[model samples]
Target: MSSPCFPPLEPPALSPETPVPQGPVAPPLPLPSDLSSLAFPLPASSPQAPIPPPPPLPPPPPVGGLAPPHVFGLEKSQLLKEALEKAGPVPGSRDDVKRLLTLQKDRFRSDLWWILFCADLPSLLQEGPQCGLVALWMAGTLLAPPSGIPLERLVQMAMDRGYTAQGEMFSVADMGKLAQEALGCQAELLCGGLGGPNRERVLRHLVSGHPLLIPYDEDFNHEPCKKKGYKAHWAVSTGVLLGTQAVPSLGYSEDPELPGLFHPVPGTPRRPPPPPEEGSPGAVYLLCKQGKSWHYQLWDYDQVQDSNLQLTEFSPERAADGRAYVVPEGGVRAGLCGQALLLSPKDSGR
Candidate 1:
């Protein structure tokens, strides 16, 4: 494959000048099918399988600046280039870029699409337990807030009223309420309350262009953290990639260069890297805004779905230490998560 779409696992810090070597790429590691968290159970496959760690995806360009002139090996269309120009001359400081991307999102090749606005969003915000709030903000960036209520204002109100600055915004109920009241949108929880891993429903939503705000286990995703001190994490499910039955185990393609039925990109050398494993060419992946600084994540389908299952009826560890007469807002003791929240503008009438 022309330069692997992902860098080598745990590779040394790389500069663009480093020459990438050509070798047999390892397949994605088999995550445990067990619905468990950070202190995870082992994978179901035999220990002798040749599964390797997943390839890491690069972070998207700054939203406030110009998008990459070239994506993969294909040159962006003139229309897309013109649109990028409309985002302004600044390379990494365009506030209007989000509005432009929301309008032109469909123009992106599905494989390269996901509403990712990370650490740079709201310069005042920092990555922390506030991931739930950040996920909401990331999703909101793709949607237009109610007239007269700028998205920035809603973010400020959340920081003032929500505990994003103090701690995590892990409460499902409170976050849904925040969406309705702060952003004038409605939030729906798709998988919860003793639900099983349901990729079909999530697939439908992603295909319909409705991204889900999902809860995840930090340890399961291998995110850097203080062991399990704060395990619950939230992210936005921007899009999906699924494999098809055809090809030399090259995997499926959302973008077929023909006038026929949908299929994963064929295993041709011309296509981007195929499924990490030739054995499981039909594997699926979920693209999420894991909110790492300058990084988006490509998670194995079953692993992420199972990750959600592990987060049922979760409660904050510090829900009780508050001053008398002033119960802390984060004192919420219980909440739910399967896929977590499905947010839409109230105007959509979903």
Candidate 2:
């Protein structure tokens, strides 16, 4: 039996003479050797977060930092070739392979980290409530650079091209295809099993140099993330910062007076979170990098008080499975849900 597929988009009946509106082309983002020369620059008026004195250098690298490439069960070349095969060629055009290159100067920059704060695209649903489509649109801008496609045009094209299926939302399963389509060229898109979180797979890809387009279960709270909704949300992982201040260790309580503790619910009067002892561990602060400095900030998505920035104590406890979980200030807990999307070049073979 044939697998069920999303219905193909029906093209509007346009006469041969009908003029097709073209999308605005954006210039490619710059990749420079100097960290200060990032392609996307911070706005001039934006405020910088305060940075505390650097803590002692990070402890020696942890064990099992990453798994061998061999565990992927395929030779590097074979892997890319297979992914390319599954990805197939562009639906209706002939173009060379699309390779998504990074701007990183060194293969290994111990202190360097990557982020997408500078490339922030307001998640406006031009066609519908599809963040996945927004992700593809933004990914295309980063991967293809100089791709000045406007948000409305990108959304319109993606919808018209049938990228959105299944309840008017882009399927996380087909994020790669959307990415390939948006780039208008053959590119490398990778993902972990839809089953659960694969930190190793994600870390391996990050270390390999490509920024990861990770999808978070809005409900999962194990990691410190800024975006929040009751449904799946997508964010890009540009890079990882090596060493930053760790979360202070403090037991959880429902009292509003507790440091690093506040109800994140907007508009509603503040209420204390559940007892930390009963909740799962999560991040209290997200260490964000701007230019050459690392600044600590509360989760941008949740509405915790501005004064609640200082974390009095760092309380991270080990879970039964040997992994350490940090309970957030507000007591929200989430574990790793192993789903992710990787974007790379056709030649990368990762």
For each candidate, give its TM-score against the true structure: 0.47, 0.34
Candidate 2 lDDT, 23-59, residue by residue in tens: 9999997666675655565555646434456789878
Question: For every candidate structure, what is the RMSD over all alpha carbons to the true structure, in angstroms?
Answer: 26.0, 26.5
Model 2, C-alpha of 205: deviation from truth (Å):
2.3
Determine the C-alpha RMSD for candidate 2 after optimal superposition of all C-alphas: 26.5
lDDT of 1 by residue, 1-350 (tens): 01112111121121279998899989998866763543744464957345767899899766645333221111335654464456444323223333333454443334332222122222112233456666676667545442334434545665666424544665665566666665656566554421233345456555445667776677654442222223667777656554443433343333222221233333334332233232342255555665442234555566665566555433345444441211234232245344366665556655
Candidate 1 wrong stretches, greater than 4 Å: 1-125, 145-156, 159-167, 193-198, 220-229, 246-282, 312-333, 347-349
What TM-score number comes out for model 1?
0.47
Error of 1 at 277 (Å): 19
lDDT of each: 0.47, 0.34
